[model samples]
Target chain A: MTEMAHALRVQNLSKSFNDNSVLRGISLDVATHEVVCLIGASGSGKSTLLRCINLLEPVNAGRIWLGDEEITRAGIDEDRVRQRIGIVFQAFNLFPHMTVLRNITLGPREALGLSRSEADERARGLLERFGLSEKSDDYPDRLSGGQQQRVAIVRALAMDPELILLDEVTSALDPELIAEVLNLIRELAGRGMTMVIATHEMSFARDIADRVCFLDEGVIAEAGPPDQIFTAPSHPRTQRFLQRIIAAGRM
Target chain B: MGDTKRSAGRGSRLLGNRAVLVSTTSTILFFIAVAVVVALAPGSDIVGERFLNWVHLKQSLLGTATAPSVAEAFLLNVRMFMIAEAIILVLALVIALVRGVPGPVFFPFRAVAVVYTDIFRGVPLILVLYMIGFGVPGLGLGYVSTRSDITYGIIALVLVYSAYVAEVYRAGIDSVHQSQTAAARSLGLSRWQSMRFVVLPQAVRRVIPPLLNDFIGLQKDTALVSVLGSIEAARAAQIYGAEQFNYSAYVVAALLFVLVTIPLARFTDHLIARDRRRREAGGAAPGALGTAAGAPHDVPGAIG
Candidate 1:
């Protein structure tokens, strides 16, 4: 991928919460249709960084450019930028009061100003793609964790975002349910949806990510092709982190 | 397995029967005691005169041949009370929503709401009406002083009930999961938008049954407006009965109250039953999971 074709770019991004900096001067880039996996220990700022990229958490400093639009600058149309990017949370935040179909259609209808029939048609098609056609009328609370997470992805995809942010999408699921969510994600990656995923699933990152980033102490420790990042990481901190995670089978 | 099932079924049936018997006997006993006290009380003539007057007035209000002059009295009273209660519900709902949004930004608003609720809830409803209808006018609030009694009654109900409704809203907002807020934000909804579209709807759903109960309370409380002598349903009946030395007027007023309150009570019961069904069908699994997750912490401190 060429530099000009990057889907998202972060430059000197920093964020603090109540005087404590959670992300400090982090910079990264994702090429169009590329899958980048962010792997790190707790409190390492991987999640914070993902949130900043999606503008779910505001950055204290620096710039985030999504294609030609400058999202990090104050007074930028944040909603417009957000419309181009979709985010899925670890908690599978499907609205409990809404049926699965409504969950997927709400953002599209409200943000994009799509008519109800059009939104419904799009939602139905997306749910069918996610193999959740039959569950469209059911509430999120009725779904298995894996199924809910998949519906969450479909909800995001229905927005037709240019880029998607996945924040530990499988972490809240049962061990048996994790694979199904991850497999759905892997399929999205295969279909060329530009994605930045914060995950602990080592095998997924190794298999699906075009580039893997190891974040530590609120900064990227190292980033490279999956093979190099996994088997031949140059940073000692990255190696130690990988060893600990692998030992815990949290990879 | 069949024997265990049979035993469990038998035990459940016995417990159910015992509960039914206990409730029925308690109710009957309570009525019997009330009747005995009323029958045996002193000042029988004065009490009987007052009682009979109330009854006669009520019967006249109910269109009985005993007193036709009081029929319009009952209708006017019922209309005024119903209007006042309706105003109270609407005002309360609005106040509750404004005070119920989560965050420090809403803290001062919530504090004010809490103070309002405490003051009104602590004060007698009659006192509140007197203050609003009489005291405010004395303070040169011309609009209030010049307004009709029905208008004053509605205003008083709105002011007092808004506070209670705010607390109900606060409770409902607090009941929604924190994760839902986070999820809405992640979806790019502004804080206000998220609360309006996502959290508030869910919170309102959870608060519906309680809201209905509050409405019922407000309905009964509307009778207090009669203290202001506005000729609301109860006061209208009271006036006719006192004049004619008949007791039916009070009975008529009581019946009117029953007519309004009984349907609301039954509706509340239906709401509660529906809520329970929803909980049993969808909530039980989540509840079990939650308890299971919490159970480990409880085991070490168990007495056994």
Candidate 2:
């Protein structure tokens, strides 16, 4: 709650794609090293909020603070802000034309102005930690769904970002492969990495998140600790949504 | 099941043999029939003397004392094509990138790119050649205007061909998904950096076959520079025909042009075939992405 401890702050963020508003009047705050998860259905604006926070998608109305700086202010350097925040997408979105090492090293070498050897050493270390050193020379398409997603995470980690945003990182993986990616996220959480994850995995969210926000329509309908949000939900829509998830055996 | 599979394979092989035999025999017979008809035509002897004279063909290729050899003159066409093609590749990509620049601040640059492509592509290459070839020299700007006609020809080819090539590059740039750009930008790379490293490499790879197609057209259009009396292959052939009153030199020139284009055409076909194979193979093939330039690339995690 203290301003000095805040890692990210979004105040009344709104975004629209033409006539369809994706995120409306959404605000949330994450403390340093704390993990927050955004849980919602298909059109619940979780992905939009993450994208807006990363400045990949410009918000229609809002202000966002990264650490001490107001990132949404006019004339702010988007590249510089993005350098401190890493994002892993649902579809991986690895550069198909680059090998895993190159994909991981491209941002540090190009944006951070790290020398080739420095970037390579950093990338290799992350790859080793993630069990992807063997696939460093291989392209993304050559890897399995799980391996590709893991490489994507390593790509974000290569920048040594202060905060990371993960948007449904397991949504595009096979059911069997989903566990590997979730385990990696759990490891990052244990390491005290500040993370904002938007996910459909009910159990993973419940286990790892310090706080959970249930988004409906374009706003966060409810926010609380995962146990309260999941087991003793207060809102009818939250109850209905959890009922659907449990009935589908997704929890 | 094994016996049936062996028999099916043998059956297919037999059918393939019969198809090859029948087609080969029919092709031979068709060529023979055409040759017989042409040889028996009433004006065959005169036509052969005028256009198919072996002696004149040899003379034109080797060159007489008065006229430059068609082969030597073709070196000029080769020079012009090489120079123009190189300039077109770089210039067209710049124009394409400029047109793709976002924000109202780049409006003027994008407008210039649009008008450039429109004016150049809309005008005929021949007209462009004439205007630049004659028009630039007419300005009489001292040393600048006094440059050789071939220089003007090369410039004209670059201008016209770049417009078409720019559109080809733009199509390629558009074909790359927005997600790729988003991923790059999110990694803290600037928009220009994202374009240079991620988008341009992929775009250029995907459009190689089409870029080669444009190059082939440019190679042939090098002949149009002869309108300025540059004495390239076509012009040399024209001179030989006029002096000797034999059209065989034109045949020699045509053959030379085809000779240069055939290898490039075959190379383009090879690239297209390789791209199709990679796309159909689910992009897991060795050396598929980046090595041979990514083709379609499995649509990014689409397999799952």
All DockQ scores: 0.20, 0.58
TM-score of each: 0.84, 0.95
Best by DockQ: 2
Q: Write the per-residue lDDT of candidate 1 for residues A74-173, one digit (tens) a residue.
A: 7887777777899999988889777788888887877788999999999999888878898787667667778889999998898899999999998888
DockQ of 1: 0.20
Among these predicted structures, which one has the highest lDDT?
2
Which regions in candidate 2 have their CA more than 4 angstroms from the true location?
A1-4, B1-19, B286-303
- The candidate scoring highest on TM-score is 2
Task: Give per-candidate clash totals.
Answer: 22, 0
Question: What's the lDDT for all of these models?
Answer: 0.78, 0.93
Give the DockQ-based CAPRI class for model 1: incorrect
Candidate 2 chain B: 10-residue stretch with minimal lDDT:
B293-302
True contacts kept of each: 0.25, 0.75
